[model samples]
Target: MSTPMGRNVIALEWLQFGLGRLVAAAAEEGLTIHLLTGERSEYAHELAELDSPHLVVHDVNTHDVAKVITTIRAIGDVAGLLNTTDTWSLVSLEVRAQLGLAGPDPACIRLVRNKALLRRRLYEHGLSRADGSPLADTDDAADVAARVGLPLIVKDSAGTGSEHVWLARTPDELTAALDEARRVALRGHLIAEPYFLGPLYSVETLTWEGRTRVLGVSSRILSAPPVFREEALAFPVALPPAVAADAEQWIEQVLKCVEYTEGFAHTEFILTDDGFEVVEINPRLGGGLVGEEISQTLDINLYATFLDLVLRRRPALMDAPLTPSRGAAHARLYAPRTGIFVGCQGQELLSGHPGGPVLRPALPAGTAVRTIAHQDGCVAVLFATGATSELALQNVLSAAGEIHVRMEGDDRG
Candidate 1:
């Protein structure tokens, strides 16, 4: 039999990314993970090679928060809880409080999840250009035009991964989006606001006791207008000393405004001609290789700090001086048309390219990709690293250009 770590940490249903890092962090901290997930297959990719001694999976209906709480109470030596998913974060917070474990405040989690409320709060504080107007079921295109104006974005206030988000430049497009919103179910009510114009970037930070550290910024390369889908991302984007300092100061204020006491935050913003405008603040690490990529870039496992927070200890990251020794980037693999995923065509070509590009598959073969307009159609991510952000981005793009996603019905591959 192997040695045992008597202490245990709780992980609610997690996002597909970052489980490996979280598991390693737990082990290093002398705490095994009691993962309460509704579906074990969601983590199949990571669990295959995981340190089995450090993690124990429990199947429970995470959606049913009451049942989730009861399950946690039965798990022995459960000292703290952590969750990176938008779907289960709230449930985790509730369970933490019921069990008397250290965690983020309940109100703070709810406020950040509601985009409309966050926009209004920031607008009141002059951090945003305009407040988002609530879209009622009875409201129409003209109502939105009069309230938030045209060229607006209509989105579910609680949406994740760019799902259920629509951009309309014309009144006709706005009408169509509104009609579609009526037909579909939303996690939260619809919210409309004037679209901020500029490139997108998400600043990853670690916070404790109202103090924050600006880890690094990731350049979000999104698709062309009408759809807000992510395409690629490069970390540690070069910024002037003053520009970087401004972002740091603004992020500190934003955190204070939300009364966020602790934990990681991935704040997405638009760099407009006027200045940086608040987009949405995710109360966890950036999704999909963002945590892993940044850990490599900084030469440190930031997830270690996550466990530190749950144990109610000062996160070492808060005191440590970070030096980003390398750069990293990732590009999404997209199929030309909606069909069943087979594999990639030119992955072999990546061995000849720079940056040491690695292809990470999100979906297994035979899985169907029904659409390319959103994140679901992104079959895999191609990650690469270099000495600088520009070079890493260049190498990733070059390697990605050679690889063509092979779909069942798409002939282009």
Candidate 2:
């Protein structure tokens, strides 16, 4: 692996707050970062802190594809390319391939992009524990549901962040789930699988070549099942060593099957009585600074490592010592109910809490927010780190209790 003289890497279509932190971190490492988003305002302020000499911005939505390509070309030489969003993940692969730059293979990224393709590929490689199939339409979807039996899980074929997922317990529930699946299919296709019930767990890791190393594991707590809405994540998973070992083995097999060559992967799984079943695989850093927080706890710069992988350089990762902190937990805060922008009370109380690890006071006083469907609004996110995963969970829950959300309109529910 060759090392570049300077840090002039590019990040594609940065939008999320995580990307901002990553940009800041990269700049701190003396890396000049470039970004492309639908608009300049989306991430300009975030990039301002870096004051990088090679910051490039392109309007992804309005810019011509050829122009975007030219824009990426104009960024001079890039040591590495990072993408925060899945769409950009694909684009980054293309750009890397065009430049003969190193990153995950674009073809492999395709399999990861579509859940149906991922399941089929994994099954072909004998990496799947549960029998799963892709739903082409309402009929095939229903048939798959019937075969998988009731109490099955239906989700988008290429979905993210638990967009359109659900659990169907009976024929009627299955119909509703199928309908929802079809609706989501209108946006894209759907992937229907047996609802594997077990302690929900996720493996966050960085893979180089074919060697997939387990960075950390988290026993995930979800508000609902099959749908898999992420509620909380507790790291340094409290699982028997053998159980975690098996899960790691499954992850390795899946990565090999999908040909995941570089960078970070957030894989969700279930520890069933028989074995672990893979829920899904995302070929990027996990959301909400999961990699950062976990890296902090373990004293590894996962973000930097990811950059190294993309840059076709060997980070001194093998020699790097892991200092595992006591397990920690991360919880998300959503509005109590759905409504227009009113505001939040007890903001100071929540931030000034004595015994909590608040990553940031994200939600301002009057940020207009809406729920995923108007049932509940995601007003704020609180990540609490503690000595133990259990203690961390308790502190986040307690802090969530401390904050008060103010909303307008009558009770819709």
Candidate 3:
């Protein structure tokens, strides 16, 4: 078990927002990036501004899948197995079939990480119009609102960043979201569906074998829901060249309904008024500063397609030559309740705003903002740039409305 010489890889733990662009796209090509991590301080601002020697920071325990497959089987002869992270993509699909490497098909990443069997398998292949009801401890809420009706949506079926998800709408808000989902604290289980409204978008593909390419369209400024947070994001959302080629042929039939061939997905849908529906398919990539706002507004690096899908090959983002210079966007800084975060204030006037809005910081000062109803109260973020995407979302919402986030809730962390 000792073969490492040059291109060694294995990043089973990542995505506290693209660890410094995955260590500068694993230092060009002569890769390295070990990082097995079980919380290297959830990447302290990408390991405090990485100076990368092709990264390598392993602590392990990564939620103990047999102690992360007995520590990447003593790291040897590596060159495949990287996960942008949906809570570790089934631990890199059980460490790539217990170390044969090359991924996909751990039963298609457990049917795309089981959103109650991907909404009843895309409502039995009709590509979903709704059908996900799993919440049984003797089911209630009028049997999931007589099969997911009145503005439903009680998520978690293997949730992530939009944390637990809830959004009821009535029946006393689905019995107060099932009494706050029987004392909320779940990473996956409760289900229910049907909340297809509008305005939300993600699709930033990259596939190889099953061939996908869209790599654009972001626009998702949520927050005014039964609670899902997610406040700002903007990117190539212009759509209308025949509606961006029919949203890239409906996300290539929703990544061929989850066969999702090679690397990178980030799906999320909901164009509504009768069209693109899907709203949960993050096999990874669109979480905060979305892959660094699409590699700084599409100049494109996209972690060099996760170093050619952990080095199996063929992924220069599927025939490059794409372009789109400026226009990026990001925005978060949730603090209107639950507190102790103590920081941020006009961020030194964000480099005299415009597009220099930087900020970042997600939870650090005394950290203890328990629940602003998910995404752990997103303590900070700003990121801007413009010339499109509605002027980079109005320059990150005018530099996140001139900063100001200093929590306290009677202090105590």
Q: Which candidate number would show the highest TM-score if scored against the true structure?
A: 1
TM-scores for every predicted model: 0.95, 0.86, 0.32
Better of 1 and 2 by TM-score: 1
lDDT of 1 at 170: 94
- For 326-390, candidate 3 gives per-residue lDDT tens digits of 78888887887785778888878778677777887877777778787667788877888888878
Clashes of 1: 0
Ranking, lDDT, top scorer first: 1, 3, 2
Quantify all predictions' global Cα lDDT against the true fold. Answer: 0.86, 0.66, 0.79
Q: By TM-score, how accurate is candidate 1?
A: 0.95
In candidate 1, what are the lDDT values of residues 69-89, reduced to their tens digit? 788778867767888888777
| Model 1 Cα shift for residue 362 (angstroms) | 0.7
How far is each candidate from the true structure, as Cα RMSD in Å? 3.1, 3.5, 21.1
lDDT of 1: 0.86
Error of 1 at 368 (Å): 2.5
Question: How many clashing pairs in candidate 3?
Answer: 0
- Which candidate model has the greater lDDT, 2 or 3? 3
